[model samples]
Target chain A: MALRNAVAQAAVSVRYVVQRFSLALLVAAAIGVMLIGKADTVLLERARAAALDLAAPLLEALSRPVATINRLIADVEDLANLRAENARLREENARLVTWQSVARRMEVENAELRGLLNFKEGPQATFITARVVGDSGSAFVRSMLLNVGRSGGVTSGQAVVTGEGLIGRITEVGESWARVLLLSDLSFRLPVLVERSREPAILTGDNSQLPRLAMTQSLAGIQVGDRIVTSGHGGSFPVGIPVGVVSSVGEGGVRVKPLGDVLRVEFVRVVDYGITGLVTGPAPPPEVYGPPAPPPRAAATKAR
Target chain B: MGDFLQQLDRWLYAALPGTLVAFLILLTLAPVRLPEVLAVAPLLPLMAVYHFCLFRAEALPAWLLFGLGILFDLLQGGPGTPVGVSALQFLLVRQAILGNQKYLVEVSFTFIWFGYAVLSAVAVALSWCAVSLLMWRFIDPQPAVFQYVVSLFLYPIFGWLIGRGRGRDPLNAPDPRVPGSRP
Candidate 1:
């Protein structure tokens, strides 16, 4: 009896000692994991994908309620704006009639030109719509997770958009979930063309609501409210997709207000332009890196 | 039958802290996309960690805290949020809770809230430093500031909700830090 009791007492003391020192060991382990994550992206992405897959069921169930609640909020806001919205729609319909005729003429002209030039039609864009089930809520990185994943034909580097405009693109894709890097993420870099000015610039997200324009061919033509669209220079995204509008132009640097509210995106369409073997982060294309040559050479060549 | 019931009850009490923390972490992942809410979603999991570690240390131990932290990071945390970063923050909270146990327990809500605010600042600073160190550039600190502020303001409501079950077996075991202390 005495021998057993002594052994138990010794074990208890040893346990206490281990428990006291365990915090340091645990903290070190945590730091070590972060270092590994920083060093090896593939491993980190795999781990992230697996983790999301494990949590998807609960996230799916929880997201339904959240979606319902958001719809309720939207309904209340819609009710408040009903009168103004009706008037706006009436005016929009009248404007659309004129634009429709303009669009019909352009379509006829474009088809005639294509036939004359024997221009090959690009493959039809394949898009999969996914529900927004996860929000990164990250301060440094702006992103969200969609319920659709590789299983739903989602691959990293595909463009994601809504009816309003381009919101972001897929950065990491798992079996059942894919994370889209938002336009406002610091790592975001897109080669876009100013629709009116026909100037090419790199849209750089600095974790701000208004991303700044960098490497513009000429800022003289860039004015407030100028529209921006993906130049498709890198070929990751299809050409002519609307991105945002120039919100400010000053010495502080040109800033753009991304079209549509990114945070409020409920359903996003992930589009594959038949481009694969994508590099994540889609580094600014080598072509766009040189000194500003001339204005919109790509568009000018296409116009002929 | 009674023995089986008792065994189940004991197991539940053991699992309660981890389960609560996990649920809150999941809640943070939910897509509550009100304007500014996605960017400034309160760090609900951090507040839960603080509440449980401070009040229920006996139930939520360091290893469990570390695991919970890992889960928090993996569940759509952030690109800035590397896998083990939240684990480090959580383990730090646990260490602080243990070291300051003598002063933290049986304290008023205001006092605990103040302590929590200080802890939040430290945790956010640690995250900022870790991310800067990893990325090898100074990140915009605005998001960190916003995260800290939101987490701070929302702690009271979290505290009240987590505190509801405090009446049930919040056993403050003997502090191992002090050489010879009793519960």
Candidate 2:
């Protein structure tokens, strides 16, 4: 009985030791992974892409029921608001009829001006419509996974938009999936121009619902309700894509109300404007451009 | 035949709980695009980790916890690329719970919930610190705060589900530390 008790105690001790050793090893491994991941190695990127490719289909399957339920709820809400919605739509249609004639006149005048100026037309943009299959859903990151990827001609750096306005851009692409970094992500930045003053500025995101404008050349004429549009500075996005309107300006600086409702982004248009070459395009001939033009003295004086 | 059957039974008993944990992690990663839910989705897998660590420590080994955490970080891509920040946080939580298992094992539901709230807060704070350190910038803490509150509310629902799956009423189950009370 003494020997048996000794053996049992020994076995228990061995088990305890094994468990403790494994636990320590796992902790070490976790730290090691963190260190390695800090490198942002290509291997990690490939692995992430592969994992996302495999998971996208499953996420699509899981989301269908959720989508259906949401649609049903929306249908009920729509039914309740049907009469009011119809009246609003009628009013909007009447207003749109008047605006349509003005738009036609503007289009004719803009074409005539373009013809007079001998303006060069930009490349036509092609779009790929995709469904959002997955999202990071963490407060720490704002990104969504699309069902279409390389197979669907979706590429990184393409602008993602909805019918409403600019939503974000594709950052990572796999064979069958892509990740879109929303405009509300902390790292997102874009060059924008105010429609009224043509003032250049940077639109920056701080992971809030409303992104803010920064680095404006002049906020002189900028005010609440001013329209903001892409400046096409980087050539990643086309010029004049309406982004948002200046919602508020205060000690906190200018905040924009993004035209896109990111919360309800069911389908998105991934647009490639073929502007990648423009960034790397050769400089215009010296004779055609002559010497560098002098900075506007008025702008410099305003800075002083 | 009896020996083979017993071995299979042992394997199932050991693997089932961990597999369920993995399933919940996968479910959390799925894109259930409920409006505004994405901004503050409850950390369902954290609840699973807390549940298994408190009631069935033997099933939730350290390596399994680490693996789940790594999967979560990878799936939830971030600005600086996710490393093992989540894994470390989970490991810390599991270890803390395991160390205090003696007191925690027999606690009532309210105490367990309170314990979870505290541990989860610690985990989120640690994660925030790790991410901030990784990015070399202080990240906004509002999202983590919102996530914490959402996860707290989700705990009881998940706890009830987990209890139901184990074929025991969470409110009336015998003390799990007792030998015969568990499978």
Candidate 3:
């Protein structure tokens, strides 16, 4: 009996030891994952992709009712504003009649000018529209998962936009889903031009409501309401895609409010410009950028 | 056969807490597009961890918390935090709570909630510090502060639901908050 008691007691001790060991080992494994995250290895990317593929269907199913409810709410709000909207639309329609003839005349003039210059057109951008199944960002990221992926011919670093303007770009793709890193994410940096002033600047997200302008020659050159567009400097994003308008300029920083309401956007277009150049930005945050991040900003700063 | 069926029933009951917490984790990742909803969604799974740690430690173990945290990071599609950051934070928070589990369990409901409010602040601050360190830049503190507020505000609902479940579980000890209750 004593022998049996000793054996049982020993068994319990061993089990306790094993449980403690396993807990410590799992904690170590988690830290190892964080350390290796920046490496952005193929194995890591594949693991993330596999996980994304598994979750996409579940997210897609869950988002449907949410989207429907949102539309219902928006419809109610629209109804509330209908009378005011109708009066405003009528006034806008009368003003648009004056601009319609001017636009037609400019189109003819633009065609003649292009013919005289013998200018070839830029590459036609082909795109696939994807439903945003999840805005998966928590505290650290500002990214959304899309319903299109490898099977849909979606590739990494493609520009994602809505009809209103640029929103962000695809940073990762799985078998049937992709993650777009949003313009308001801290990791996002884009080469953009002030459409009116033509002064070049970099738009960098600080995880705020609006992203700030960086690397501009002069903040004085940028003013409130000046349009921001992709500069096509690195040949990744297509030239002249509207991004946002300068919404503020002061001691706080120059900020651009994205034209598209990226947070609430239901669908986004992933456009393939047929150019596979590096994603435009240096030291692009993390492996989210498919290409290995280049070393610090020395070369990019000099080039600018 | 009766004994075997009883054993199976007991096993299934033991699994319920983890399963419920897992579902809550998945719910947070769902694409709820209400304005500011995603930005300020309460950290639901963490609430589950806190509850289970105090009352039903056998059901949601430390290793389970580690796994759920990693899953949260993956679902978040983390930029600076693809993995491990949250897992480490959960383990740290779990350790802190479990170390004080005896006194915490013996306290009144209000006292328990106060303990949670304090611990959760530390928990959120730990994650903010950890992710900021990983990024090598200080991230905005605004979202984290908002998340903490919503989480605290919603705690009573979450705790009441889970507390009722704890009372119903035959394997669990009596609720300390119940007057005349004894361990």
Choose the strongest candidate by TM-score: 1
Clashing pairs in 1: none
Pitting candidate 1 against candidate 3, the one with the higher DockQ is 1
Best lDDT among the predictions, by candidate number: 1
**Model 2: per-residue lDDT, tens digit, A1-304?**
9999999999999999877687777878888887787775676777677667666777878777767776776677679999999999999999999999999999999999999999998888888999877778576788888888888887778889999889988888888888988888888888999988999999998877889899987666789999999898888788888899999988888999999877766788998886553333353344637776557796588788
| Worst 10-residue lDDT window, candidate 3 chain A | A280-289
Model 2 chain A scores worst on lDDT over the 10 consecutive residues at A277-286
i-RMS values of the candidates, in order? Answer: 1.6, 2.0, 2.0
Q: How well is each residue in B14-55 modelled by candidate 1, as lDDT tens digits?
A: 788889889888877788866454466777878888888886
Model 3's TM-score against the true structure? 0.84
Candidate 3: the clashing residue pairs are: none
Off by over 4 Å in 2: A1-18, A76-87, A277-304, B1-13, B35-38, B168-183
Error of 1 at A192 (Å): 1.4
- How well does candidate 2 score on lDDT at residue A103? 100
What is the TM-score (0 to 1) of candidate 1?
0.86
Poorly placed runs, candidate 1 (over 4 Å): A1-17, A277-304, B170-183
* Residue A221, model 2, lDDT: 76
What CA RMSD would candidate 1 show?
9.4
